[model samples]
Target chain A: MTASVLSRPRPAVATPTAAKPRRRLGPGRAIPFGAAIGPVGLLTLWAVGSAAGWLDPRTLSAPWTVVTTAGDLIANGRLQDNLAVSAQRAGLGLAFGTVIGTVLALASGLSRWGEAILDGPIQIKRAIPAVALIPLLILWLGIGEEMKVLTITLGVLVPVYIHTHNGLRTIDSRYVELGESLRLPPGTFLRRIVLPGALPGFLLGMRFAVVGAWLSLVVVEQINSTSGIGYMMDLARQYGQTDVIIVGLVLYGLLGLISDGAVRLVQRKALSWRRTLAD
Target chain B: MATHAGGLTATRTVRVRSLSRGFGDRTVLNGLDLEIGEGEFVALLGRSGSGKSTLLRALAGLDRDVAGSGQIEVPQNSSVVFQDARLLPWQRILDNVTLGLRGPEAPQRGRAALAEVGLAGRERAWPNELSGGEQQRVALARALVSEPELLLADEPFGALDALTRLRMHHLLRELCTRHRPAVLLVTHDVDEAVTLADRVLLIDEGRIRVDLTIDLPAPRSHRQPQFLAYRESLLQSLGVYQTEG
Candidate 1:
């Protein structure tokens, strides 16, 4: 969790000119602008080619078609309901994964005995493909919401656990010396030194967990679901409703974008110390 | 153990008898004996691989493997300042200054410490935001914040440029005079040792090779011929010849 790379100081801001207006663009500016470039260019090319009949419309629907269909889905209240279901599953799974992963990682990092007990088991489990566990999870939990949540939890836990453990283990030895020299109590050391030291890594793990939760939710929902975005995609695929599939894909991408944005915001707030170092 | 049990105005604030230390098979300090009196500033000079650092570490109680059952009974704990500032990178300047304090009451104490170190306006600045000299000051503030009865500095200003080092030496002398802690500074600079220390202890081949007292006034300048004479002698003891000007 001590991946210090992400918080690297941004390059110095460009100097202002009298003819040019300026606005503050800190870290998040790069993300949205960078993300917009590819999709916006692709959409522009598609719209121009399709309108000029250089591209086939019968098979490949236009951007307007995707947008209109999204409207239709929303009008029926189906999109909101499905989004609500997917969010519920992902939220619960993330809560479970982060809590358990952090606790286990701390134990492994702090104690040799805990590492001995956990290392092999965690290694073996990490290699087990999350998708392959779907059948086992279904058989054990009967394809209920619990199974979906558990699947997402499994998908999210390893990265969080490994990152957290590494972060905790890799703290500078000098901090430990400082603790000893100061004669800090065990609880105070853990709280004041260990936890803050591990925070950068922990936040990175949460970012990974958010993305993992989304990926796991889609896969889990595809297997068996009464209501969710993935379920809608599955139903549309059976009926050759490729347009619906496109809509669902767009929604999923947007959900990922939004969640990642949220996580980055939290990262900035937690690491506001970075602002002081920026030139 | 370099602590001594002598009363006020004791012959030595610290005394080490048959002290030895090693890491596994590599012995750093070999049966070294030393003594330092109250109100005395002793500079320990050595080559890179010599045991000067080990000796300082032992005096600070940072080394558990020091040989011999010697006694160290200082009035209180010794404050240590290391080579690299070693300030917690995540902490603000003020917070770093108060790094030794135990509780929530440390903020006010931290600010006061920063003010004492001439860094009053930088309380909220992060460690990386400070210049090299400023960072060293933060480290000094942290060491001095607790009002330690003894100060152990292991090349604390080794990373600084010459001018900055001079300023720091004066600041250190002023602070030591004000606080009057028995100071043991380890340095490779011959002039620095002769200028700042009331006494200089030269460690070579894991033993004290020379112990010479420097009789100079407070805030002694390098321009004084007497100071230069002592510097030349100490440099000669280290096998360096003073160039005739």
Candidate 2:
């Protein structure tokens, strides 16, 4: 075992022989693409049941009716306006939460005094539900965009804070030693070592923060709002516009899928180094 | 290049004196003193827990816990390569080699070092993509690129397969010949020590037990009678070798 293993030098890495031309798989791509057929089939079954009078079309509107009502809402400009308002609220809230949470997490993760002063309060804040604070936020900030943004920010902050802190704390000690051995200045060390090392976890936390922002936006908008998708859904329910409600629901789901997909694309580009482990 | 940049002639000797270190309830080294000349390769060979690593760390100024009076003055700062590669997982291959350099010409120097280690084309590869031997080479490149006056290596090639280990030993010798850093290598392998070092110092029970200087030429044969005799002497001094009747 020893002699044979020791005798062989490392094999040379195979060089690429040629650049293969790209081939288009337009029709051939349809098989793996059709893997989504199961969810589409379920939606069709629901729509058929509702249309054939076996189900209440009033509550569970047929797919075609939902689509038509969505088109009407879009034509009237109400859907776009509501969507813009909700998106603004979620975007602002996520920005606020991410900035504040990341700063606090870095301070706590690196300094003993910061952790001592902040950990107790952070633990208490994490234990309480963000939705339960709606009444208090409304009392303080009034029933307006401030209240909605505050609620969403509160929801997003805790997860980002936890994940960022954990990420910073978990950087390998060897890296710190390496920096020390090099005699790098403090600012250079933090910039080159600490920030880059903690990035993957910090970005992961931001993704969770984005999702939390949407969830909190729904609850906040439902509670009180003049505009936004959740408020539109509430308005539709009062008038018993079941199709309009379904339209609003479908739009919300689509917005969520798009937001999550955007985060995933960013993750792929930033963390291509992580692909080997994923495989 | 061996001359100081300020036009002052570089000091040629490394002076380490009265070094001591210990953890709570366990003393590792006591009052160790040694002076190494410039361009010297000294191998510290010993059993595990025999204070070889501790002494190396103390000499490198990595152990702040030791309560002892030791003055080590070299022309420039020291660099260490541990048993593990300790390469940053995020950085590309060339970046790992350039890790500690703090000047404008770092990338060019890094490429030169990588080329010296026979890893010229792998600069853009990720750390995980490289084999174990390649990773060790990167670690060596990182240590060597600084052109440190003193290099402290603690079993740096311990994880390599024997053939790779032999190649790495040869590479170290070649680099030392050109750059001429005073290197102190700690290893458990006796043949490795006998081949690589101009001098071998065996540390045991927190003290230097054996100090011998070899006048053999570079690329000396392991099969030579003198080489075998020195190997036997070292093995016997470590109390691990039994002769045939």
**Which residue runs does candidate 1 get wrong by more than 4 Å?**
A1-34, A48-60, A275-279, B1-13, B64-76, B241-245
Residues A114-231, candidate 2, lDDT per residue (tens digit)? Answer: 9999877988988888878888988999998888888888888888888888888999988887787776688877876788788788878877888888888889888878899999
lDDT of 1: 0.83
Best by DockQ: 2
**Candidate 1 residue B145 C-alpha distance from true site, Å:** 0.6
Q: TM-score of predicted model 2?
A: 0.88
Candidate 2 stretches with Cα past 4 Å from truth are A1-38, A275-277, B1-13, B65-76, B242-245
What tens-digit string does per-residue lDDT give for candidate 2 at B1-245? 24444424445556666766778767788777776777889999999999898887776667775665567665557888989888888788998888788789999999999999999999999888989999999998999999888898999989999999999999999998988999999999999999999889998888888998776766777868888888989998887855642
- Please list all clashing residue pairs in model 2, or write none if there are none: none
Model 1: how far is A272 from its true place, Å?
3.5
